[model samples]
Target: MTETAVEQFTEHQRKRGKRVSVVSPLDAPFFETERGSLILGDCLQTLKSLPANSVDLFVTSPPYDGQPKYGNGEKYERDWYRDFFMAVSAEILRTLKPHGSFVLNYRSKRRGAERGVLQYEMIFWLREQGFLFCEDFIWGKPSPPPGKFNRFLKDAVEYCFQFSKTNDWQFFPENCLSPARWDAKDRERRKKLAHNYVRANAPSGQGRKRVQAGPDMVRPSTLLHLEPEFSPNPVKHPARFPVELPSFFIKLLTQPGQLVVDPFGGTGTTGLAAERLDRRWLLVEIDPTYASIVPTRFENGR
Candidate 1:
């Protein structure tokens, strides 16, 4: 027998032996810890209850267009991309503060030699939702999934689209600085030319300053090289991103005590990253069992 959504919520609370404050009951706050809260429900529905402009940063990777089945993850038709993510974008834009940033990761799908357009379509749609197209980063995975066909070149990259509510948002480039890899000869050349000033063409009404060999600092680039070794024994999640992935964005876009959100917290990777960085988090997962995995994964390393 199928229980109603309200009935199921009440039953879940009773089974868990905890009292939850209820208003409409569609959205249920499943658990809370020192670092953050976890909600067990559909993100689209649960996100509706959050206050407007309350979140500081959002680091998430929604299920891509042609992903395999996972717990409680739906399989939308090919034509469902635009409307589905548009609704989600509107909600995310609402919860995001004027100075908030959203970093989204989407993978490119291939059907034989054909390429998918969901990732590009999402960028345009999110922009229409008033999110400024901040930047497009590539996660260059030297080691991609095994078992590739000969029809297409081995896929080795995924897209991370960074967006903001307005043109301005919180960002700390210093937080995720990449290690410098300058060659010895280049370093020596720069040192020899330190006293020399390199001039550039000045634009109209703009004065150009001479380029100097400033501090040998390295800023993170649009291409992120995050490649982790795969283990035969992984967690139950079918599509769990590495903790470092979200951690990079969390440190780059947010600060301590600021609120972070993951509308698609598969195995709570984002939440764990936020917790480690002293940022408050809100994770919304649709599957009860998967949502149940978050606390255990966070409190004790998995």
Candidate 2:
């Protein structure tokens, strides 16, 4: 919780648990914002040292075995993929605050007519680890046409699986809604266009300025509409989420000054999102090359 703990860095390889040389200052991201600090290293060892139940939230997507390589030059063979997920999930459970939430983002691939087992397995394991299940939201990426697969159009969406350690969790609906609201005429028109559909009228305001109101059209069961930005990467990690993605969760589950940790901090998108939202953050990346690039990423922010 103090700067001293984070200032002291230690490296431990699996073979020899002995501590190595101190991390050079060049490895740090310029702490431009007071909201958070970013650390670069193997997540498992780094997380072990943190105070248990100290982190306010855990928001990250771990590397899946069969997914495209993340450009780390290391291939995770599928044979032992389940074991890998378990190991990492256990570490995540440990650091989560008693009432904190841990949200995971993952894409499920189709093998023939069936979907991958990762989603189902993850939900089960995560619950067993004491996390209460919250509904899953689909992150529909509407652009960048799907690949030419045989039967389907293949509009792939990322899943945001939300979980919390305790029933008393934080989620601010105000943070996730669009700024603009529909007016009475707009709602009436939309409702008339589709019978049986209901649209809440926008709130009225005083003076010349229209006070934007009327509960946002109830969020559709599924989320669509996104513009593609190149995945954030100094080392060019393959899979990355939009900064808006983290903004959604941060606004929903945490308050300003609460800590956010991303175990797989590729290109530091999560850190960037946290920076903008005024939340503290800790990022762990195994690749040295990617670690070195974290600071340069701050030049551009959400």
RMSD of each: 6.2, 8.8
Best by TM-score: 1
Clash totals for all candidate models: 0, 3
Per-residue lDDT value at 222 in model 1:
83
Writing each residue's lDDT as its tens digit, candidate 2 over 263-283 gives 888667898999888899988
Model 1, which residues run further than 4 Å from truth? 1-28, 71-73, 188-217, 228-235
List of clashing residue pairs for candidate 1: none
**What is the per-residue lDDT of model 1 for residues 1-302, given as tens digits with 9 covering 90 to 100?**
11343454455557667674543225436556788877766788878888999999988887766665664457654555677667777899999998899999887577666887778878888887788999998988877777757877666788889999887798898988776767777666765663554445676654535454445576888888877436332335566677888888888888899999998887677888888999999998766555655655654654
TM for every model, in the order presented, reads 0.81, 0.75
Off by over 4 Å in 2: 1-33, 77-81, 179-186, 189-224, 231-234
